[model samples]
Target: MQPGQQPQPSGSYYPQQAEQYAVPPMIVPSQMPMMMPGQQYGQPPNVPQHMLRHGYIAATFGTYGETAYCAFLKCGLGQIPLMFSIPGCTGAYTVAQSVLPHLPYGWRAADGAPVILLDCIIDQTRGPVVPQEVWMPNSPRVYDQHVVRAVLRPPTFFVHTDGSVGLPLPQILSGNFAVNNANAPVDVGRSSIHLHIKIHGYTDRKRQFQTQESGQWIQLRRLVGHVGRAVDKYLREAEPDPEQPVPRLRIGAGGIVPADVVVVGVVHVSSGSWMPILQLTRALA
Candidate 1:
């Protein structure tokens, strides 16, 4: 599937002859409002409607320059910092990846693309202060101050299961398990299921935040790392007995065996950290 596209069943975990399911409509860029820098949008009391949709304030850098542009998003848990830097005269810029957990699940655009808030601050004086490079040789910059909608791809999941059936890790983690029955008649009685999941392409860059202890910069790797470790520990604690053999099903009066026992074993895959990036662009006003 393409980046940011919804997952399709592979029949690896579903029962055969299962019917196809419909995914919810994706959020498109046109559905969101466009605003310029310093323009006032949102309800009274200083709350934006888009922020209400995701239950958190979204912020983006409205200005750019040759050296670097920095901004922050105020997630309820913590502040997510973003930095975009241009090293050389090639005009190429690298955006700092922002990481936050529990973002509204399945919040995509009307075109089935993922939707991320591009915070547009109209007040140039009040918005994020763009650091100026005085002695820099290359002065690359973008002067437009407007909001635009953009797209971003989603992450990939690698699932390891030791049981009578294989299941998609994303669906299971997202609590959408109905698709598991699309392949064959799933025998829910089998209790030997243990799942090990690894996610890829979540975060591309290391992020940092200020701490109370003398305002030191610290990497945000723990957010993703803690989750992986917690999941691993949970699966290990729930592991089934190693010596038990998988039970076989017998059919017909002659006791003929038509299907082999589906005993799956979990294979160890490399684990790593992930922090997803939100691709943004200037939407036409």
Candidate 2:
């Protein structure tokens, strides 16, 4: 067929005026023609142009919608192996032909579910994407630098209503900031300035929620803006004590916190509000 020239239909061609006909039986995987090296599996050479145009490819080869398989392909991995095993089956042929092109390089299905790749582990309990360590055979220096950077950085905290905090930002951002009161609340009167302010709710009037059901944590950069507003509200409500030096909160153009204060933890209230706890230290002279 010429490039972009629509192929004409042959054999039992149903014109627009033809009466409805019975649907054909589905072709099993074994009955489908073997895919040539350069040919796309679904678009087999033997299949009629009309059948391929009507999505017979998917119907004949089965669905290509496996989660892990799709994710593996999205990461730019090549074709799935033909000899691997799948759960409840002995060989790869049991899997749909369409899904075969998307499976991870060496991974297989387990209990009819996608097996996690070693370089990208999925946390089943938390249902959150967790970072995995990747090894680079040829780039040792780059890998070492990445490891050092990851280790030195502190985890982002999510403050709960009861003045407790959760570590690592991902869970909190995903709306899992439930209250954990084990950790003590920061003492505001300590020698070092530790700013602990309860985030009651959004300052935006239109987005306000009940005090009991507030505190879903967003990105830390956005949270800093809310913190600024909270501090302003506190300053307006209370009288200025002469002995206490005003705590200065400075965020750089790129949202880097000044050295004086470090974010410690985020507390989620029973009512679903989030509070941020910051530990303040003397800035370098």
lDDT of each: 0.21, 0.27
Q: What TM-score quantifies how close candidate 1 is to the native fold?
A: 0.16
Using TM-score as the measure, which candidate wins? 2
What's the TM-score of each model vs. the native?
Answer: 0.16, 0.19
- Go through the candidates in order and give the clash count of each: 23, 15
Per-residue lDDT of candidate 2, residues 80-110 (tens digit): 2222334322212222223333232222465
The CA lDDT at 149 in model 2 is 18
List residue ranges in candidate 2 displaced over 4 A: 1-217, 235-261, 283-285
RMSD, one per candidate, in order: 24.9, 24.7
Candidate 2 structure lDDT: 0.27
